[model samples]
Each structure stands twice: as structure tokens, then as C-alpha cells.
Target: MTKSATKIYILDTNILLHEPFAFLNFEEHDVFIPMTVLEELDAIKDRKKDVSRDARIAIRALEDALVDATPEQIAEGVDMSQYTADHGSTGKLAIYPDHLLNQKNLTLPGPENDNRIINAALHLQREKKPREVVLVTKDINMRLKAKGAGMNKVEDYRTDQLISDIKYLSTGYVEIDGSFWDKVTNCESKTEGRDAVHSVERSLFTQPVFINQYIFDSSHSFAGKVVAHDESKVELADIGYERLMGREAWGISPKNIHQAMALDALLDTSIDLVLLTGPAGSGKTLLALAAALEMIVEKGIYEKIIVTRNTPEIAESIGFLPGTEEEKMAPWLGAINDSLDFLHKHDECRDSSMKYIMEKANIQFKSVNFMRGRSIQNSIVILDECQNMTSSQLKTIITRAGEGTKLICCGNLAQIDSNYLSPLTSGLTYIVERFKDFEGSATIHIAGVMRSKLASFAEKNL
Candidate 1:
């Protein structure tokens, strides 16, 4: 889309579903919601789908803006500044009646909602004079169709995207070039309890550092955590390479340094949140399951384990299945059960051992939609396959963590299943960036695939 001095953004339904009050993100730009978009939201608000709550919120936001306005005021444009006037938003909010569109050859003429939305933007482009009318949507095909129909400005809604590329995401570790000890000239070293800590000058490092981020050297000798830092100094808690590699969660041990770092963070009672991101066979789920078992059953740090994930439109499909929530969700949660099976595969009574472990751990399966309004205390929440979730959805789950509860979010960015989300806008990416500076949160992108040689080759080449 070309730059414009002033512009009007036409919002699509998916934009609101991705973010309920997305209009607030467009600071000072005029906003238009096509009538068809409202109709779609209304049709969706009463459904049993997990997105129905978002649809209701979107409708309420629109109503709050136009509740007091007359029909003429709404048609012309409502001030819509009641919510964000202090944030420098000066643009008007209005609704365009696209049902009355009679334009000939309206963009691959069809009664489909996407076609209607494209035609609405085309109508605005023709009537709004030189002012740009940009169609903002999360649908790629909708954008293509709008552009093919000669609509000049079409774009994806990206107000919530933090990074343009996935590689820029933090991996919770830094590799020193040669020797880390050679760079530490001035340092105050001390032993607090069993931990060896050193306060080193901040100028020794050339890159930015974050709390709980690991620092390691190729000398195969030194490994440490950034426990604290300030403008002039950074504090490091020394963790021997031997200790990290030798750490155990349940009966599982780290196969590599990356997994070792993740296990360290997971086992730490001080850290409340841990995020794991990697490819398909990177051992994210396996390590998380092991840590969860250790915390809940062995260490007695957390009382239970609650596992959940965002399955696209599971609400409708789940109703037709039989049995309880966990039993019905078993098909989707096969990965977790598979990890359990692997954990006890060597036992003579493997099936009985798995059931005993489940009972002993107090494991429960829950849907993401039912997480709100509940305080999860004294539990370890293992949220798997969350690459497709939205930031709002993640916030709901994270905030559910009450006292003595820890949350682990695991995902592979390459396997995002949501049409409205990309690696840049995924909830996992958003949290990994948002919580990098948080003292109680640590994120690790596991390095290699441990599933099999063939799985690793497929991940790299295919």
C-alpha cells in the first residue's frame, strides 16, 4: 500500500477474530467496518466454537462506540474516541452499508463474504476520492482477490507482530567466541550459599543480555546464568558444565547442552514460566513432560499437572466424541500419551505403570476456552502445540497461574496451523519476546532433533 497523508482502514472479520478490539491499534486513522463483517460476527457470536467469545467482544466494542450516535451520525461517522482519546486517536469510526452495493463487475462477482468485503473496499476506493482506502485482513486469499479486483491498498493486519523474522527471536543463550574468562578483567566473585556468583563489569560484553539468559563458551569449561544486571555491572551465577549435563528430570537426561539449559530453567523453583520452541522432533514435549513429572511427583514442588493446547475448532468436533473431557481429547493429545508410553516402555507392566504415573501425577486435560475465571494453584501447566494460539488466548492461560503454579509453553513455529497467524504474530513468539526481560521467565529453542536420524534429516532438508 502506498503512503497517504490520511487513510481509512476497512476491517475484515478475521482481523477482529485475531484481535477483538483491533480498531484501537490504528492510531488516528479513520476506521470502517463493512456491514457484512458485522453480520458475520453476529452469526458467529452464538455458536459453540471457541472463537464465539471473541466475536461477542468485537460486537460489544462496536456497540460501545456507536451507542449514543444517531443514524445520520453513524452513517457519516461517529467520533469513537471514548476509549482511546488520551492515546492521540483522533479518527472517526463508521460503518459502511455494503448490502446496498450495486457496482457492476464487483470483483469476481459472488455472494461469498470475502468477495463482498473486497467489493466494499473497491466501492470506498471509487467514492472516497484521493484518500486511500486500505483493506486490512488476515486472509491471504482475500487480499489477493482484493488486489486482483483493482483495489489499490490491501494489507495484512500486523499491529501485534513483534518481529519480522523468526530467527530474531531469543534462544535464551549466548555463545562466547573463544574464552569467556579471558574477557573478565575486573570482577567481584563470591559464594552465596551453594551458588558461586560473580559481579562483572557490563562493558565486558558486546551484546545485550537478559535476565535468566544462559552464557556458555566453546572451551567446554564455563556456563553461567545472568541472575541480575544493572547499568554498570552484570551478575552471573556460575553453573558448572558438569552439573548442567548431569542434571536429571524424572528418569530423563539432556541429550545436548540446549536441552540441559532448558532442564535447568524448568527445574528451578524460582522461575515461574518456561517457553520451549523448536522443530517437529526437537524433544520439546518430551523434556517438558519429564520436568512436569519431576516437579509434581518427585520433587513435590507442584501438586498436579494440567495439560492443554489450542486445537482449531475443537469445540464442535469434541461434542460428537464420547466420554469425559480427557477421554474425548485423547486423540488430539496423543503426543502427550506417547511421551508417557515412552517413559515407561521398559516396565514389565507398561500399561499399568502408565496408569499409575497418571494417577500419581494427578494429570488433567483441559481446553483453552475453559481456562478463564479459574485460578490454577500448586500445579505445573504443560501447554503443548500452542503455535496457533493468539496473544489474548495465551494471556488467559498465563494469568490463570495462581500462587505456586508454573506454566510451560511448548511449540514449533514451523508448524503453525492457524491461517490468521504467522511465526511473527504467533502467541508463542509474542510471549518469548515479551518475557525475555522477566526475571521469572526463561525461553529456550532446543537445538537438535532427538527422535531419529531420519527425523533430523527430514527437518533440515524437507
Candidate 2:
């Protein structure tokens, strides 16, 4: 595209709050931040929350970028490359003054902040004729309002999206035909303890399979886990249902093939990261907690279990809550308590046993707000309800894992609660796609709901 034809992206406040460095995403195109947006950012910059922190960061970045520049230079726009290294972006950043538009002639519903931003875009479009002005926002309503106001170009902020569609996500397991066992039995064999292993032709499947993915042969009632694969052959390790289901972790057994695969990944020390996606009643949290308890209390793998999650509110502020960190987190940890209850009931443990388990397991509830700048080592870190998190927040939490730490992220894409996040753009989806091919990472999608028959019916029909 030519210079005049290059699109200009007018960023919404939520875009900056969702990601502080969003201006750098537009390559060679101009990025405009309305003065109204700056006012909103200034209003919330001092709040004790992530969005406030981001607002402060955005303001500071702009100030630092415009340090020695003149008012004319600010209006004309400043080169973003001077502030940060180019990540394939040559965008110029500018702060546009609030423009008063004839709202009587426009179709805006009201004179809200969003309408003001749209009016500013409209003003820019009128000024820079033929230079496409697009409103980039994370809010669906803002995009609609922009279109209603006669702006032709509008788009979601998709710079961090890992997958375009949710259907392409990994289900973590594949069903093999009955012929798979027959072909495997014909190939070279080896014995490992009570399980038999073999190397079979890679052409058995029409598509490529991932490493550490579970394989099941429903026709022959055979189950196996993929150990290795190459162009010619795939190494399979027999994982009998009897063996997997019989092995109880904190008195919880696998209710389905997907749960079994999840447990296998959870128990294996070789795999350092596990991603589980499913519906509400799919036992994702229960299985993760059980495995963490078994590993921490029974197997002695990790020193402690650190549980954290993105606070439920889209604009979460923890200042209102009272008491210590764990006490404040207790309200959000209902799922963990429910899982503990089930484990206690299933194991037929008395109060003493529950107390012992709680004390010995060394469970710690850390807030996601305070997870930065700390290195967690030799711990089983569980990030629950991760679908609510943005890709950037998830990256921050994941990078905090130190040596010998196993990170298990659990979330349901169908039940995202964050207004700025969707199934395709969620952090859970981001990690699933980014780490699916990695050697020490595994992603599983549990299809069945084992909570109850009523819950299953509600999930499907209601």
C-alpha cells in the first residue's frame, strides 16, 4: 500500500488497558490517541489494578516519547521507533485534540466517551480524506457504534490472537482404528514393566499427531500414549485403561479417556506444562488439584502447590477485599474447596486426614495481581480460570515459573467471562497453540461432562 493509502488506527482506551504497547503494533501506519482517552486514562491511572497500572504505563510512555519534542511535533506525530526497537513496525504516534462534531446530523445514540472517540475518528477521516481511518477497539459495542456512525473501516485488536478459530484447537487425544493395534503388533516390540511397547508406521493416520498425545483404539479396547514420531514410524507406549484408572491420585480416578490423558500428563515429570480446556463440569479443576495433591503430598515431586487465577472482574480491583492475601483469595477459590471436598469424601478421610493433607500438601493461594518479579521453583503452579486472562497477563504468569516447576493451566473456552476476551483470543487458547509443538508441553480438551447427568444435560441443552 502507498503512504497516503496506509491505514491509520485510532486506538480505544480498552485497547491500551488491555495491552499497554498496542500503539507499536501498527507498522508504518499512524496511531492516534484521542485526548478524551488520555483523560479517561488519567482518571484511572492511580487505581490499584491492572488497568490502572497499564494506564500509568501508557501515559509514562507517551510522556517519555514526547520529552524534547515541541507541540508542533506532538501534533504532527512522533516516530515510535525512537522509543522502542522496531518489531516490524514503523508507526508514528500522535495525540489528537478532542474535536466537536455535529452530533445532531450523526446517528450516535448518545454523547458517551465511546461516541466521542468515534466522532474523533470521523473528524480525522474527514481531515485526511482517502487516508483510511480505522477504529481499533476491543469492545464489540464500540465497533458497532463506529459502523453506525458511517465509518467504513473498523477492526478488533488481533495482534495477540494465537488462533483464528476455536475449532482448530487441540483436543489432546485421537482415536486409532482397530487396524492400528494389528499393525503395531506386527512391528518390533519391547517390554517395559507390565506394558508392551511397539513402533508402527506413521502413515496409519491421515494427519500428523503430536508428541505426548494419547491414542485409543475403541474397537480393540486398547489405549496407548505417543512417545516419539518421525517420518517413517511412531513409537507407542501401551497405556491400559485398567492401569490408568486403577492408579488413584488423591482418591480420584479417570472418568473418561480425556481425563485419563490429563492425569497421565499431570503425573509425568517430563512434561512441564499442561493445558486443559473443557466445559464447566468436565473435571478439569478436580483432576488438576488431585494430581497436584498426589504429587506434592504423596509422590514428593514438588515442594508446594501454588494456585492463582485472573480475578473474575474485567476491571478487577482487590483493594475492597479485607484480610490477608489467602483470606482475600478464599472467595474466588470455591472450585478448589469443592475439589478438596470431593477428594476428601472419596478417600473416606476423617477431619484429621484432611488437616494432614492440607498441612502436608503446602498449598498456597497467591494472587495473580502480585505474581510479577518472583521466581517460583520446584512447585506445582495451577492457574485456574485462565480463559479470563489476556495473552499478555498469561505470558507474565508463565514466565515466572522457575526451575523444576510444573505449570498447569485450566479453563473452559466456551465460558469466558472477560468482556475483552473471546475463545479465539483468550490466553488459554494462545498457550495451547503456542506450546502444542513444544517438547515438554501438552494440551488436552475434555469433551465429556462427568459432574452429573443433570449438569451434562444443562451444558448441552440449557
Candidate 3:
């Protein structure tokens, strides 16, 4: 394609910080970075957070791309094909070094970095006439502002979006037709312990089902787990109602069908990775913690419990808090304490047994900042509020799991607080979609909120 035919994508600072490799996603297109974005990245590179790490990575990548190249070559653009060859992207990376405000007398309200970025895109649009100039950003308000400023083309960075509409994403359990029970009864069945395992033809289902996914009849009397499947047949293991609803994890029981499925996934030793997504008051954190306690304190399955979360600050940094690492992490771990309190109230031993259970369980509160480079083993690691994490951060955390480690990621996509994340592109959704078919992984979406009547009402109507 000609130069004018290929679109020019101007990336905002937040997009780069969200994903350092974002420039590689635009295939065969010209990627332009405003000077202000580089300045912003430089300014934030010294911080002790994921965004700072991403900024450093982006700066290093750009510097490596421009290494040994003359000023003339830099102005012309650098060939970023090598960096993006794995992604099938042939984009050329360029820096818009010229001062946009000086070149074009635009009526921008202020000299903010966002406006400067917009001015750069507008300048490019005017200079490269007829060539599409699209400003890519994760900021919704910035997109609106760009459009309001007469910039026609603006788009979201969509490399990590597994599902366009999250409302339509699978809930990990499907209600089969009424005839499913008859089909199960007729299929080859054999007793495996107390449960009967069945093999049925794939044609029995009208749609495809993922491995480890639960299939329940409309009457809710029979539930089956998809153990294995091929083009022709599916091996299903019957999940007893007793195993689903009757099983208790440290004094906590499954409150609904969604929670039942979540508990099933959580208690299964074969599944190493479990992802739980839901709205607030859906009991995601509580269920995970209860299961962890049962496994650690009761069953002696795991050596310890490690709880961590993405510390997305709404106002100021938590650095001002005076304490050691564990104490510093205490504020972010209030949910864990709350879950423990609920479990304590329901338990027979009350506060004493609760304290003993906590002590014997060897529970450790960790920040996501210090998780990298360490191989965690023989532990149940719970990553709460994962919707605030980027896909790269999720990958880093998951890859740290050592032998005999079970990683449980819990988050509500609707409650994502990160400015750069959306329900579709958050790390929680990324893992849920990517690991749906993996044998050792399972994802459950809890749709109901059982916290309280008032909380549920607010979640539904407000």
C-alpha cells in the first residue's frame, strides 16, 4: 500500500503506559508519537509502579529503535518491523518532534499534554491530507475532546479486548435443553466412586462447549462437567448437587448456582488457575479466601495462602502510610480481613479458632509490586481486584506460579478503577477468555450479589 493509503495512528501517553508494546499492534501503518508523550513517560519513569515500568520499557524500546540512526533517518521514521514481526505488524514508528502549537494557531483551551497531543494529530491530519489520522487512546474523555475539537478519527486501543461486549461473555455454565437429561441417561455411563461419568456425542449439544465448563439442566437437578471433548464426542463427569451446594469451605457455602460453579472450580485440585469475575457483593473474594483457608488449614493441601491485589489509588499514593511492607499492604487488604471476619462469625470457634486458623494457615499479604522475579510454590495465591491490572501485569503474575501453586484471580469487570483499563481489555477478562479451554484453568462469572438486600438493590437499580 502507498504511504497515504496506510493510516497514521497517533498514540496517547496512557495507551503506551497501559501497554508498552501497543505500537506493534498497528499493522503496516505509520505510528506517530507526540513529543509530549515522551516527556510524560520520562517524567514518570522513576516511580515504583507498573505504569513507571511500562514507561521505561517504552522509552527503551524507542531508544533501541532509533539507535545508530542519524537525525534525518529519525525524522523520516524508523523501521519497527523487527520488533513487531511476531505480531505480523509492519508499522513504522515516528516521533512528531515539531511543536504543534507553534506551527498551527489552534484555539485549544489550555496547554495540557492532552491538548498538545491532539494538536499534534491535527497537524498531521492537515499535513498528510487524505491520509487517515487516527488518535488512539484509552481515555474516553480525551476521545470525546478530540472529536469535539473537529478531529474525526479517534479509536480505543483494542489489542487486548477479548470480547467487544462483556455482557455477552459466557458465564462458564450453560443451561442445557430439557432433553439433556434423557441424552445423559441413554449415553454410556459407569460408576466412578459416588458419581456416574457419561460419554455423549458432541452433536447432542446445539453449540460448542469449552472444556471444564459446567452444563446444567434447566431444572437444575443435574449438572455435568465437560472433562474432555473432541469433534465427535465429549466426556462429561457428573457433578453431584451434594458436591456443589453441600460442600463447605471454612464455614462459607455456595450461595447460588454461580457461586456453586465458582466453588467447584476453586476446590478442584486439578485446576491450577481459577478466574472469578463478578460485580460487587458477588462473594468472589470471600469464596476464594474460604477455599484457600480450607485447603491450607483444614486439608493441608497448600503450604500457605498469599493474597495480593493491584493497588489502584483513587486519590493519592499509599506510600504516605507508615509501616513495613505487610503493614503498608494492610489498607488494600481490608476485603480479606472482612471476608475473614464473616468466616469467623459463621465458624463454631468464633474469634479464637479464627485466629488459630489464620495463624496456622500462614496467610501472607503481598503487594503486586514485589511479585515479579520470585517463584512462588506450594501456595494458594489469590489476586484480588485484578480488573485494574493490564494484560502484561497479569502474565507476569501468572508466570510466577511455581510447582504445586494454585493461582486464583478475582475481580469485577464492572468495577475496574484503572483509567487505562476497560471491561473488555482488562487482565481479568484477558485470562478468562484465553484460559477457557486450558485443562488446568477454569473461569466463572458470578451474576448474583448475595451480600445484602440493600447492596443487591443498589447494584441492580442504581
| Model 2 per-residue lDDT at 78 | 88
Show where candidate 3 strays beyond 4 Å: 100-104, 107-110, 177-179, 182-186, 190-195, 314-319, 346-349
By TM-score, the best candidate is 1
RMSD vs true structure, all candidates:
2.4, 3.1, 2.5
In terms of lDDT, the poorest run of 10 residues in model 3 is 312-321
For every model shown, what is its TM-score relative to the native structure? Answer: 0.94, 0.89, 0.92
For residues 36-82, could you state the per-residue lDDT of candidate 3 as single tens digits?
Answer: 99999999999766678889998997887778678777777777776
Q: Candidates ranked by lDDT, best first?
A: 1, 3, 2
For TM-score, candidate 1 versus 3, the one ahead is 1
Error of 1 at 411 (Å): 0.7
Best by lDDT: 1
TM-score for candidate 1, residues paired by index: 0.94
lDDT of each: 0.88, 0.84, 0.85
Between the candidate structures 1 and 2, which one is better when assessed by TM-score? 1
Clashing pairs in 1: none
Off by over 4 Å in 2: 81-83, 100-111, 181-208, 220-222, 226-246, 314-323, 346-349
Model 1 clash count equals: 0
